[model samples]
Target: MGADERERLFQRARECSGHRRTWSEADRLWTQVIDAYRQAVSGSGRVDPNDRRQLARALWRHGMLLAARGRPAEGLATGREAVTIFEQLNDAAARDATDQGRDEALAELITAVLDLAETAFAAGEPVLRMDLLDRAVAAGLRTAGPPPSAGPRTREAMGTAYHNQATALLHRCLTGTSPDEDAREAALAASRACELRQRLMDPLRPLSVWEMANTYGLYAQCLTLIRDLDRAATVLDLGNRLVELLGPAGAQPALKLRVAATMLARERASARGGTGQRRWGWRRH
Candidate 1:
């Protein structure tokens, strides 16, 4: 195919990726996108940096699709290549610090790493998941620091990155292999994520009920892990409210919140005992 034809096919593939579709359809479109980009790269006598970056993006999308479709081995191989491409772009961007394109490239790199991390976790490779999470956090912090100029989307992505890290930490804690420090780290990361989510909130761009519920639920879980029962209860309540707003689809998470809240309250009560007075209060017989 000519360059123009390849470009047209790529654009169509990108557009198709944006719409809500079944997993099978998404897999097919992403495959087409990857093949188109591969053809374009093969036909070129000398590939330009722009063309290479486009190929990286296509590979990244295809890797994500593969992961979502439960093909982790293929996803891992493709994702690694995407990461290498983005890392080179990151270096180039750093050399020319004024170029906004490098920053965007780094952001996409972080996203790709995170997507692979999810796949790793799903595939029961906890160690790879942690490594990817650490890499993503490092990349995001290095390139997307302090998002006043990074805009709402960047800020939201940062919030998501932090949240993902926190959840990973929480998973570690739950595995019984993590030290006590893991719980503390999880709580801290969760708190940061919560604050970012709150900051990112805009009246014109309200989060989906599912997003709100998941964030709140994850934050509450961290609080519970750290034994901050009161805050956990409050956050859990907030998540439950969002889940309610999500209609019948939210029933499962809402039920989960209810169960977790009840368990947390019970644990707190068991720890506190039946006492009528405060800790400082002078309670007489």
Candidate 2:
């Protein structure tokens, strides 16, 4: 197909991919999107920055879907491709931008790193995951700068990145040799994420459903790792309430699963506690 036709197809695929759908439908649409992107790139005589960005985004989404569908190796390859493209774009932007531009480039770089880290975690590459997380944290600090001037969207993205990193650390704490050190570090990262998310949505609004599901569940897991069952129970209760607010079963299957896991953890904590029951006395609705 021609470049214009390919772009149109990519757009349609992106729109289709965003809607609620069965895995088969999602997989088909995402594959189509990737195909369109590849066609456009091949048709272009010269590299187009916008086309590269679209392709990177498509690849990243496809990689996430692949990981979700239990194809981690292929997903990791696609995710790495996306990250490499994003990094190249950021490097180019870094060469041309001023202070604000620099911040934006750094933020984008941080995001790309975190995205790869998450993919690595899904691929069972814990060593690479931790290394990427460390790099992301460093990039995030630079993105924030002296006065902390990142926009709300950037801040939210960074917060979510921290949460993902923290979750990886928490997993290590659960399964690794140095539980105490890993737990402490995980708690610190989780707390930072929690604070940022709270700042993003507090008093006037609550976290977006996915953010609520992820942040609270992961934070509670960190608490559980630290043997703070009471606080973990409280966090799980908060997450459970978010699940109740979801209004229907299967509206967000992944989020529901996370919430369910949080509930199970709370129940286990309750069983092991001194009082022989949940401290919060909260039951899943």
Candidate 3:
């Protein structure tokens, strides 16, 4: 098929994938899109950079669809392929003497890595999830550059990556064998996330406010884990204030913030030598 034809197919697949009812058709169209790209590459005896990018995009969408449709393992494999292609593209972009498209390529790479990490998490592969999240964070940092210099998209992606890393670490800490080490790492990740979100904050954007508040809650939880009771309390207070800004919409996060506050208070009491209290004994949400 021609490039135009393949693009039309991909667009159709994208539209279909956006809705729940047409997912099966979307899957079929994505397969045709991939097949067309493969045929074109095979006939030419080489892969065009744009073609590789389009193929990777198709694979990424298909992987997400599969995962949403209850085929997580298959989705994970497909997502891995997509991430590999994006990684290759990123490496090539880094090598280009002209310095063309490097940031765009890195952004895409970070996105693919994060998406694949989510698939891995859904597939119950925490180790792979953590590794991919770490890669996403690294790529995000490269894309973001120095403070106040990164574009809005770059900052948002970096914040998301850090928040996800912190959340994943905390989950592993709660469920796995290593609590102390993971909690410390989680604290660091959450701190970065909070910093990025702070830069991104705007009172006009309710979603941004909500995200910052949620991140604050997560940061407080991390602080509590590390026995930083005073800091946790302060963070929780900030989170609660953000929640108040949301009015009724913040009810759920407000409850979570309250719980975090209680946990912090308990930790403080324990720090003062309260008996029969477990250190780092916050309930897992």
Give the best candidate by lDDT: 3
In the range 65-113, model 3's lDDT, one tens digit per residue, is: 9988888899999998998888888888778823337667776778778
Give the TM-score comparing model 2 with the true structure, all chains together: 0.70
Model 2 lDDT-worst window of ten: 276-285
Model 2: which residue pairs collide?
A: none
lDDT tens digits by residue: candidate 1, 1-285: 666776676677677666657556766766776676677677538766676787788788777767766788788888888888888877887687454665676677777788888878877788899889888877767776764456455566667777888879877876656535787898887777777777765535435455556777777766766678889989998888777677787765676576556556655665689663212111110
Q: Give the poorly placed runs of model 3, Cα more than 4 Å off.
A: 45-48, 97-100, 140-152, 204-206, 246-259, 269-273, 276-285
Superposed Cα deviation of residue 262, candidate 2 (Å): 8.8
- Candidates sorted by lDDT, descending order? 3, 1, 2
Q: How many steric clashes between backbone atoms does each model show?
A: 0, 0, 0
Candidate closer to the true structure by TM-score (higher is better), 2 or 3? 3
Candidate 3 minimal-lDDT segment of 10 residues: 276-285
TM-score for all models, in order of appearance = 0.79, 0.70, 0.84
- Candidate 3 collision pairs: none
